[model samples]
Target chain A: MKTIQKQAQALLCNSLLASAVAVIFATSALADELNYSNKLLLTGGVSQVEGAAGGGLTPWAVIGGYGTNNEVGGSVHYTYVKTGDYKLDTYGFTIGLFDRVEFSVAEQSFDLGKLRNKVTAGLGADVFGRNQLTQTIVGLKVRVAGEAILDADTWMPQIAVGLQYKDNDETDFIKSAVIGAKSDHGTDVYVSATKLLLAQNLLLNGTLRLTKANQFGLLGFGGDKHDSYQPMLELSAAYLLRKDLAIGAEYRMKPDNLRSPANDLLFGGANVVDLKEDDAFDVFIAYAPTKNISLTAAYVNLGNIATVKAVGADYGNQEGVYLSAQIGF
Target chain B: MNINIKAATAALLATATFLMAQPAIAEVYAQNPNLGNTPMEGTATFEAFGGKEGLVKIMDDFMIGLVADPRTKPFFDNNKQTFIKAMLVEQMCELMNGGCKYPGRDMKASHANMKVNREGFNALVEQFQFAMDKHNVPFSAQNKLLAKLAPMYREIETTTGDAVPPVFPKAE
Candidate 1:
């Protein structure tokens, strides 16, 4: 399993490098014919952790690149997040077509420091030795109604529907026994509405998602407690201070499906590990010095991931700083 | 050609009626009060541009920028440069409710012959922004005016192809 994991990582690194080279060549070769970048700067939102165009935590309705109706565009992004107990690194790329459709792929590697140590100590070192969990997400979105930018005078907002398929790399025993996961993969479907009140220099977005993933599919999908898909609401609001600078806040609801009292009875409730999930939020400032580059820094609050009473390990409400950078046409 | 005369006649009749109603208010008669988008609610925005004098200054720089920008040069480097600049100033002044009215064709009728694309339209807007910046217009005031003009893209951009400037006979 370790060898397979190493090989998969190596393969992924090689493919990413190749794709980067190909994207650079394609952009330069088709500079005149494609990717006109007619849209205004920063109109294409920064890439989200799941590779969608949006604010820090939630996906907005805008496409992922600065493409207008007659052009194609794309972007690449890297995000780093650190909490009191863990760290997350995400990298992704997205392609936008004619300002209507978007396709994205992202990889998230979550380093579980205290949780890994506690679990390994409790279950013995040989049972679970991995220090991190990784997941791959592929996303597709299509704009269905209205225009966020040109419709500045109207109440109508841009609406889009999208889906993300997530696959986690984890052993069956670790998923089923440690996290009580029913599956290692799942899909999340969402619909988003975004409005840019150009006169007020404000942008607002709301999204409703149907998902069954646990901890964004890093701990796997579904759960022993509740296995049905649930609706989660996400919201983002941004105020443009200048043409190239914006400050925003986001709130994303998360499902609590891993806390099972029934499973606790198996251990006579003596060593129950509470897995109640909490909603996430962030306050961010994004700045673009040029059309091709954007940087974002945020204060993120992702409440306690899990707590193990048996090991006396309580991962306090995890709050930390998040930083992201993006480069694109 | 006949349609142009007819439209002109209709506009003149409308202007006559408007003049009779507010006889003492306007120094310059107009073809249509509707030439600009809905007039802004308050005089504060008009005052922000220093009234008509400020608009003239902005338009002067704006025309130069338009002619210099490669993407928009074809559209503005024409024989009717003075007329176009005057129309823009009047349109913006009336939009801000500065006691002025525009005597120009509406957005669609005027740009009908030009095949304006998104790229060209955006380029024009960028140049206009530069002109406003050069004249030290307050950013918020600039945005207020932009919000009124931004929707004109619907009427101005009529094609996905490269923009082609319309040819007009020089004034006799």
Candidate 2:
């Protein structure tokens, strides 16, 4: 059984690795004759959080300076988020078409609690089990409104709609089987709003998200939201640190639904334990040395699960820091 | 003082004449049979910039000062999770390098709606000049760079209701 789990994990990892190659092929096949801006790539704007206290997404913010170049382009980016023992790492390539549409393929690996792994079935131990989760994701974003890179006037928000398709895989043998779904797929739809407030040399940003992925949980195992709605709010403010640089902070909130439906088995319904968590806070700092590349670092603090600790595992989840780098073609 | 003024005028005329001669040299260099023909020799890169290695340090130092500048302070002072730094570094570096198509929007399209006046524009340019100076960029190179970037003003500045580049040229 242990060997079987190892083999399954290997196959998934291999497939995920291959998708990087596939993304490149898809891009080439679609548009063979396009010379996009070889110009400097632009990084994330001022707003650090989702909902802006002052403004929303502007046209310039949506395309990251690409929209101004009047062409299509692509980029390779890597992001790493760490909280004590918890880490989420992503590597992906994003392509923009005439600054109208953007497509991306990303691979995410999450290590929960960075906890110790003990293979007791006499298999000794490998770096296999700090409870890592890997996901293959494809996302599409469309710029929907507004003009002007900076609005000295009232906040004219630039809005975009995006969709992300996520596929998840787990490693542990016992957990995978109990998950009832070793592999699962989820779709997320999101709307983002950004604005650059020129008066204060400040930028305000925010986003609205609706998803049913059970909070990016284990082995793609998400609780049935019963089509329930979860609302997340993020507010960020960026002050031009200099002519070419900006630093900002963000405050965000997540869903609060983590528990099993009582007596669903006795009631004769398909039974699945629902484990989710309360809202958490994440604050980050970003730096753009130029307009072409950007570096972001942040710390995330997730609140404790009052009910979960009563069950079995001690998530002891505290906080972690992350550094992310982005490039635009 | 009168003698010094006369001397400076003569020197200025000489400089103008020298600058005029350079374009001719560039043309002759293009036709020269001695040196292997390079298409670039036909035109004057020197006319736009001091030379090939001009913009590098100027660009770098401008950004370095930008990150340290207090006038532009609010943007990144409190950042913890954002990666704007690396982006700007690469972008500015690319801009300094010749002919890289900047993927960003037009200065006007990006800044038009933002209403930057002469004062704001002057402040921004001052920062740029400081950065270039700190990096030891030559005066000619600085002039050339400014010439190339001057037109971007249409995108970021207003003339009628707004203002132009020289916020307040000292009264002679």
Candidate 3:
């Protein structure tokens, strides 16, 4: 546990240092006459959960930053979500170069709330006092084909490939006891196709991810039951009410690795808190008053979060509010 | 379970209602009050732009902007600004179905001798967009007009040769 904490801290520090260097390099290369060229305002999309440019939960083909083909741009975002039993906060910075490649670093902290006390009491020790699980993710996205805004009239959708490396801080609890995860770290690869129907004022995106991440690596990675890599699908559709305001919905399928252990060997059978992963969806509204800043609010349904029973109900159908603020150049 | 179904039904109904109301909402917002007129396509947009008078002003501003831009200035060099502006106004009037017949030369024939490249054409478009912005033309209106004019790219650009001239003369 101590070793994992030290490694997580080191990784966070390194990510911060790298991001600072990148910012300095990008600022130095900026020109005086900043122009967006053929890019439409706010078509670059906002940062997603793992800090890639996309919808709230799924990554899209559009790069995160405001940079056009001729210039460099970057953005910083903070996201917050609160459910009945857990609270999640994520903050990140992403930089896009020539609208071709994007790089990002994000940190997510999940608070288990009162479940921490219950779990510790059940364990007959202060074992789960450090219930705040922290995960650091570094991501890269490269545009491979088409253009989202310029080719709005065409049938071709913009496509991009992305990779995210996630590292979790809590290692011991994930390894053998709770979820039986094999590792504390994993890599996720995804390809996203996004299209903008400018004439109809609609946007659609689909993403396929190859991953073995459990609960997006918050619970752990590669569990004993279903540890192999699996392909996941994420879909998003949005309607632009105006050039600046958009309402959308996103559906993301999760990997169900926890199949309920045979005996009550792990953590009591009925009380064992099943890790039944379920699909999640959200209805979101994004408003961009300017080309440089955007505010997004969403009603999210993250089904069956950490299986913690609360208020005479399991943590199934976990409904929550998601809010995010993004500022870019 | 009953409450869940009721809540779900209510949400669906609200979504359906909002979707049905969108077209009317779009109609209300499309008529920008700041522009002092609704910018519709076809004859309505032409009349809203003040028919011949507004077109002449737009052409004048567009010509001024073109002449001032270094990237597009060479294309207009040696040409009389008033003559070009008059021809453009006529072309725009015809394109907008403004009940005006354009007596100017066709786009392909006029630009074939000039050997206008894509960059030059794009620069001119940029200048036109700048002029429209200066005139406080609504964005939707500008795009409506631009969509009609955009098809002329193939006719106006690169009719003779593929070689593109540099904006500035090369020094010895």
Candidate 1 vs candidate 3, TM-score winner? 1
lDDT of 2 by residue, A184-265 (tens): 6666666666655543446665555555444443344343333343444445566554444555655444444333443153
Of the true interface contacts, the fraction found in model 1 is: 0.27
Name the lDDT of candidate 2: 0.45
DockQ of 3: 0.07
Q: In model 2, state the lDDT of residue B52.
A: 35
Tally clashing residue pairs in candidate 3: 0
TM-score of chain A of each: 0.90, 0.69, 0.89
Question: What tens digits encode model 1's per-residue C-alpha lDDT throughout A10-52?
Answer: 4785597469647844784565454334668788999988889
The per-model lDDT (C-alpha) reads 0.78, 0.45, 0.70
Looking at model 2, residue A185 earns an lDDT score of 63
- Give TM-scores for every candidate, taking all chains together and pairing residue i with residue i: 0.86, 0.52, 0.71
lDDT of 3 by residue, B107-131 (tens): 6666655666544655576688678
- Please write out the lDDT profile of model 2 over residues B93-113, one tens digit for every residue: 333443332344434554443
Among all windows of 10 consecutive residues in model 1 chain A, the one with the lowest summed lDDT is: A28-37
Worst 10 residues of 3 chain A by lDDT: A30-39
